[model samples]
Target: MPSRAPDDIERAHLRDPNDRRFTIARRLPPEPLRAWLRRFWIPVWDVPDGESAAQRVLQYPVCLSITTPGYSRFVGPNPGLSTTVLEGRSWGFGTMFAPAAGAVLSPGTLRDLAGTHCDLEQIPALAGLTEPVRVLMAEDPSAEETHAACCALVEERLERLGVPGEEDLLINAIVEEVEGDSSLLTVGQLGERFGLGERSLQRLVSRRLGLTPAWLIRRRRLHEAAGALRGTEELAELAARLGYADQSHFTHDFRTSTGSTPGEFARRWRDES
Candidate 1:
């Protein structure tokens, strides 16, 4: 298990500092696979006999490959928040694919799979990964050797997909730029920076990530808010900094996506911590 303080973790995850039901660890893909693979994640969990814990994520706009004891599948971009309930003792081995990998992995257009997932066995090219990863995670869910073996298996499979092309790399750049820079507030600003017109940028993101540029921006803002609210920052000041028109608009956006007001969320996080 990786020993990371809750406050130091990635903002995309909505983690409770007091929750001890699960542990997560991350490993980077080797250099050659970086163009297609982001990183590998292994999460092992144990809950009391009759209770359950819910894990939430503000997912990135990319595809995912996950294998657990009972299932193996490819997950498309999630349009909003993602939640999974956990019980008993178990583990999951997952690959967070880069933006460029969606086109190569999807049997049809990536757009068709948004907000959904497909079984790995349903896709012939990736079917080889299903059984091997399942067996490894089931046999030794917590060993470093087991995790390394899983990554080696995936590396072999993804290497056959070949190198990402120029357009594929461009899409990667576009997505990274949006997530990395907070000052990029509008789609027009994004397009101007990339030398792409509005329509062209829209079509490109739709084709590769199965998401609109506008939605991506909104999601980033919410993720930032989720992290910031853990502190003592004033709501109005936080809203202004994140480019929201007003605090009312900020509260509405946060509640719409998270089912909790910004103030409510901040209080809950503080109470737990």
Candidate 2:
């Protein structure tokens, strides 16, 4: 995959400026794990007592997160933006799984988890790994140590479950194609390009990802739009570029997903900086 250039407006998608109470760091897993793992992300936050900050995200297609003082859980894809409020001092380490990789650790289809979370220990494949991880996390390990521990745990689980199957690879490819290509404007376009009928495409995504193809496409487009809003582009042009019919349509969708209009979002980033 081509790396994003420094000036690429899409880089803003990786972060949010509305909340400055935390720092996030990411590390790639070992090469052998790249097919099923995207990266391990650690977020460390320190806030004054009685105050809180809201962290919002245009989350990826799927994730399996482990948090300190919280249960390890598998989070499926959500159709809209997700937000969490942070208070006091806190930290969390999470693995952003490839679209189909979650299925390997899940007891049922990914659709069952869509827009929801389940305790990771409930999954037979992940049952025994959480306790050791909890012990390691309690000691406040360094980033490198945490990454190594997570990699090792995942490796052990993969050994027992076997490598992700062909279906996983197929789902990963479809997600990558849509995410990497901005020209893919609609689910129908994706269906045609992937050579699957619209209904079949929806079924495949629902079964493996627990999300509708339309939701996936809309989420990707909204992510791009949110990123571009942090830059200087005109709303109409950005909306058209993202395949919206007009500026009004884009504004409505953007506000609905992010709770702020494009202009207000950009201005907040500008004023914050």
Q: Give candidate 2's TM-score.
A: 0.89
TM-score of each: 0.94, 0.89
What's the lDDT for all of these models? 0.86, 0.73
Which 10-residue span in candidate 1 carries the lowest summed lDDT? 1-10
lDDT of 1 at 99: 90
lDDT at residue 64 of model 2 (Cα atoms): 64
The TM-score measured for candidate 1 stands at 0.94
In the range 1-273, model 1's lDDT, one tens digit per residue, is 222123333677776667889988778788888889888888899999999988878888899988888788899999978898989998899888899998778998888999889997777667878888888777788888888888888888888988889998999999889888999999999999899999999999999999999988888898889989998899999999999999999999999887779998898788876
Best by lDDT: 1
Model 1 spans with C-alpha error above 4 angstroms: 1-9
